[model samples]
Target: MPSTDRRHDIDALRALAFALLILYHVGMYYVAAWPWHLKSAHPASWLQWPMLALNIWRMDLVFLLSGVAFALLARRAPPLRLLGRRAWRLLVPLVFGMWVVVAWQAYAEAVTRGAVAPGPGAFVLRYWAMGPWPEGAFSGSAFGITWNHLWYLPYLFAYTAAMCLLLPLWRHPAGQRLRAACCALRGWWMLLLPALPLAAYGLLLAPRFPATHDLLHDGYLHPLYFTVFAYGFLLGTDAGAWAELMRLRRRALVLALVALAAYMAARSLAPDWSEARQALRALYAWSALAAILGFGHRWLNRPWPWLAWANESVYPWYVLHQTLIVATAFMLAPLHLGPAAEPLLLLAATLLGCWLLTDGLIRRVPWLRPLFGLKFRRPATATPAPVRPAAEPIPR
Candidate 1:
């Protein structure tokens, strides 16, 4: 494939990844042992099994896809220009999301925990002012504010800016050589070598720092995410690498499953066996990603009718989904809906809210676009086709 050609597979993978994230957040509500902003009336311990499988690799896949998106965009614009655009697209939504889009989530959590009385008016006033409220008021109450799920935006923006700053080195001969070596890996090297660094991070940093998701304090995640992000940029347009991934899809899937089983077994059999489990976790993470990308390339690389709409709507939906999930759960809590009816209604309501608010309101309003990480509409005008074709559109 040409460097400029649209990678429909990547687009589909990214959309599917975000969709999985939404589902995972919904699962968070009902997972008995895990902590979320809010919980369902009926938390299922069995959820831990499936949630563990997904939790290992889901965000890594998302970050890698983001790196791929960055590589695609970098081809079209100068580093400085790209940096400016990324900052606008990421930061604007982050600020807006923290203050406005995520306000309901924080409020719901506080009310549910008895941290605050239920009053949207008063809560909004206090939240907007960045309250120094009673301890345990919300997730990030210690910092006087919280971004919740919107943490991804700022982290992505930081990574983008860092990559942009490093563009000069990335374009240099040494960088190209490094990129070439990464893309040239084959078979077992491709499968296992990429995971060593992840294992190292898990063993070295995770014990001390943990995943706080507070940006500045996230020692382990910064390295892990940045490394995978760099991996995506290196392999994004490499046809040979993608071909290898597709060829290895089945083997990778098998390996991922085996790794997951081993990791879980180790945890159950010997809870203190940290080193082996971490290695297994890293192995599972990379293998699962490879299988996902490979299968996506083979099957999802198409221009489906709904893809265009999905591509555009995904950002707003991501911003809106968790809030809807939280608020819906809160509203339904009073009625004492059973587990079966409650989660079903929560899922339906969340999806409906995302559709109604995003398509019905946000997309139509010009001013609201940037606040949700969408581009402003350009006036329709005739223009000549350029020598280089536009790249595939990836979710921000």
Candidate 2:
């Protein structure tokens, strides 16, 4: 159970991380060539560097927070029950929200690019087809409803399911022994495991892969993310273990900063050197992971006015914002909005529209609550009235 005076800083971190996701996606609107661009899209050349830099450490932070929240949830809740709840909460959204939201995005894109807009009947037909409507005329095939930004749900649900299966064994002595052995490896070697898996996965998809989150098929990296999440779980439950690691925060921060600088410099100097540059990026990614964990452990407790509200709204916003964003962008893209104005309008509209939809409509409508993750409440009941005050004045 949460304490009445809860330490809300962690929740605040979740909110902050989610809010950053929105901002980064909005940035994608104006930020030169985003990672999502295919060669056929005729994307702007200038957006590449900004996209690369912003893309580097964003989702890693969110994934780390997921690990932390998972550990916290497991502290009191039965693991089986918790896992079930997660499936309901996450998997349901994954299946339903993706089915619905991604279609809207695809529809908007189709309409914007002068393709035919599918009505309900045509939509049903197209959705049942093998793929999305043909990519722009030359691309040869329609782009169906790809995962868009919602790939995290399925990936996260898979990780949670794996964790649930391992929970019993993880509590066993043999499991403890195995974990200890793994931990005994030097930090540098330990780091290699995650990097190796990531590299192997990336190589499998290389030339074909764009390192963006929206691509559903590039989900092989999720297991690597899950490993880091599992470590975070261990840290939260093992208590002083995290404190000890956190003692190296300053060093981790320095390494993270230096690695990031090197990554930027490499990108600037040799934009064509993809493999070497990505390797540098991978190094900095790990460094950023360490820095965020250490810094979160050390300094994330400070309060901010928006944290609680942001926490409450973040989930609904995440679930509902994409369609709104796509629509908003499509609406304004034709306005000849300046580079600055496009991103600004998209961000403001998506955030404000999502928050109001969640806090206003969803919360008020019982049937709609599940979609927005609003808590169910029981109706108020009458209670015994307080005893009437004695006639003290008369006695006096």
Candidate 3:
């Protein structure tokens, strides 16, 4: 759906945001007071501050970018066909990952926690057979299967399908007015407009239904993610919206810094949720998103060779990264490597494994490609040195 004119900025942002996820997940292995598949022996309380900064808007940015991709695809295919392509591209990976790839993460968690007696080799068979293991340490513990970190695909696909169902309304009068309003947002309004839906969700639904990421019952996340996805669709399709973001980019950054600072200060006073805290939380979340979008549009628009490959590889990397993190950490944690060496080794192992597995194997091999959400055919070469052709099929 990315036109002949590529938005390398989106590609850059997507790549960078995901890169941030890798670092943050590494932090998750060590961040204090957080429950995860595996935890470091020495958890650092200080990590909470920086982790919160990235945590609020990282996934939202991905959802927003996905909506942008959807808008581009909407121009090329009918809603039904687009939905079909997304299912083929996304659902296959989600299902394949759940059945085959993600099982390792679950096994690592259960074994690390002493919830399961056996090693991953034996547990994989039991897991494949749908036996719920003991202590329920893995994600989706009650069920025999779990997507683990790959929960985004199902949620994104459902949102895309829902948007397709409403395709007719996208160009209707009210929808046009809505788009116009978004494109017209300027200065402070541009900075704050997208936050309203998210704010409403945070204030209302988030308390009642906490984020389980289970896909079926996460009420709070639906409204917020769907709204951001819709925001991406509308704004990405509107040229004026790009111009507006450019104009407000600096302002958005300033607002983001101030809001984040205030959010931090409020955390010091009373970290628990209240109506005022919810509103501030929403404001902080949305501002961070705006800053990223505005900055990406302003500075990241130019085409670059590495970025094109990074863009195409984003989905596969997302599918593969966290599992590698958990597995790598699990293996290294026993070495008494200390905080410094353990994380360093874990990150190195994760990166090496992902590169070898994703680029060396998955990208080149035809049959295994679609299983990880990659196009079946690619230049047999490593990411093409020349950028333009590579950028065409996959939108930045």
Clashing pairs in 1: none
Tens digit per residue, CA lDDT, model 3, 1-396? 235566777779889988889998989999999988889998999999999887888888889988887887888898888899999998999999998889888888888778887666789988888886675768887887899888899999999999999988977899778678777877788777677777788888988998989889999998888888988888776777787787777777788788788778777887764766677777888887777887788788887779867966877888899989988887787788887888788889888888888878888888888999887885566665665665578657
lDDT of each: 0.91, 0.65, 0.84
Better of 1 and 3 by TM-score: 1
lDDT of 1 by residue, 143-206 (tens): 7779999999889999999999998998999988988999999998999999999999999998
- What is candidate 1's TM-score against the reference? 0.94
Instruction: Kindly indicate the candidate among 1 and 3 with the higher lDDT.
Output: 1
- Alpha carbon deviation, residue 291, candidate 2 (Å): 1.7
The TM-score of candidate 3 is: 0.92
> Using Cα atoms with residue i matched to residue i, what is each candidate's TM-score against the true structure?
0.94, 0.80, 0.92
Candidate 3: clashing pairs of residues: none
- Please write out the lDDT profile of model 2 over residues 1-396, one tens digit for every residue: 133434455677677777778776665655554433211122356766656665777776677678777877876788889998988888766766766656666656656555665454575457546354655621222445555678788778877888878878977999887766644544445344445545554445445654445435555566557766776566545544455445656676676677678878877888887776666666667666666666675666565677767766788788888778776886776576665666667788998898788888766676666655555555457999766668635444
lDDT of prediction 1: 0.91
lDDT of 3 at 336: 82
